[model samples]
Target: MESEAAIFAGAVFSLFGGGLLVWTATCVHNHRPVAHGVRPVPSATLAGVVAVLALAIGTWCFGRL
Candidate 1:
């Protein structure tokens, strides 16, 4: 069985990534080239990349379970 921490991390990361993805979509739909308020520097491309990485890490964690 996976530890409690792994489960927690997986859930958190997955949710965060999903949220990021949604935010990105909203920005794109609005015709904005950049997303703001998530990080120190706002960027559309970076946001998308980070979202994917986060989701990937979350999936990896879940796979461990």
Candidate 2:
């Protein structure tokens, strides 16, 4: 049987991962076009940070299981 701690950790990972995905999706700015036609910095940074955090959290949580 799985331990309570593992189950809790897994739940937290799932929640955070899903939340991060949703947050990243909304970080896009559709109002303006870039001068250089490149992706804006803020949205990219937001996605990167969220993705890294989610990965780190998931790895840590899975390791505990």
Best TM-score goes to which candidate? Answer: 1
True-structure lDDT of candidate 2: 0.64
Candidate with best lDDT: 1
Candidate 2's C-alpha runs over 4 A off are: 29-40
lDDT of each: 0.82, 0.64
lDDT of 1: 0.82
lDDT by residue (1-65, candidate 1, tens digit) is 45677889999999999999898888778876553455423577788889999999999988887
Instruction: Tell me the number of clashing residue pairs for each predicted model.
Output: 0, 0
Query: lDDT at 61 for candidate 2?
Result: 74
Which pairs clash in model 2?
none
